[model samples]
Target: MLTPESAAKFQEFTQAAMGRQTQVLINNSVVTEPWIRTPITANRIRNYCN
Candidate 1:
């Protein structure tokens, strides 16, 4: 379900969180290690796209 807008939003949110090194949150819980990776990674997104 990673549409362009959501993908862009993810990047925007993460980029905004740069420094202080905070992880991404979903339902008030940290998901992955900041910008290193997420539950849905780019490679997986490409697979879904194809």
Candidate 2:
């Protein structure tokens, strides 16, 4: 399960990557949506991981 903090961290990483126009790689590829969108919730991250 991903906590709120973890989700926030993920959001930060994605935002940074997109802001810089860098390619964001997903280890699981299942988290693509949140990685492309902003303000991901903990539930979303948890679901992605699951």
Candidate 3:
């Protein structure tokens, strides 16, 4: 869960990264590079499994 401040910061980042390819990194390792289609401003993010 993101705190209110973190959520705002994430929103700002997404807006800045819009229309660009972004990399997800963990422990200095690249995870995935996804194109940013829209800005995400939600405070909570969820991953669903099938």
Best by lDDT: 3
- Point out the worst 10-residue segment of candidate 2 by lDDT: 30-39
Quick one: best TM-score, which candidate?
Answer: 3
Of 1 and 2, the candidate ahead on TM-score is 1
Native-vs-model 3 lDDT? 0.83
What does the lDDT come to for candidate 2? 0.51
**lDDT of residue 24 for candidate 2:** 33
Q: What is the lDDT of residue 35 in candidate 1?
A: 42
Clashes of 1: 0
Q: Once model 3 is optimally superposed onto the true structure by TM-score, how far is the C-alpha of residue 49 displaced, in angstroms?
A: 11
Question: Which regions of candidate 3 deviate over 4 angstroms?
Answer: 46-50
lDDT of each: 0.51, 0.51, 0.83
RMSD per candidate (Å) reads 7.3, 5.5, 2.5
Give the per-residue lDDT digits (tens) of candidate 3, residues 16-36. 999998876779887677777
Which is the better candidate, 2 or 3, if ranked by lDDT?
A: 3
TM-scores for every candidate against the unseen true structure: 0.40, 0.39, 0.77
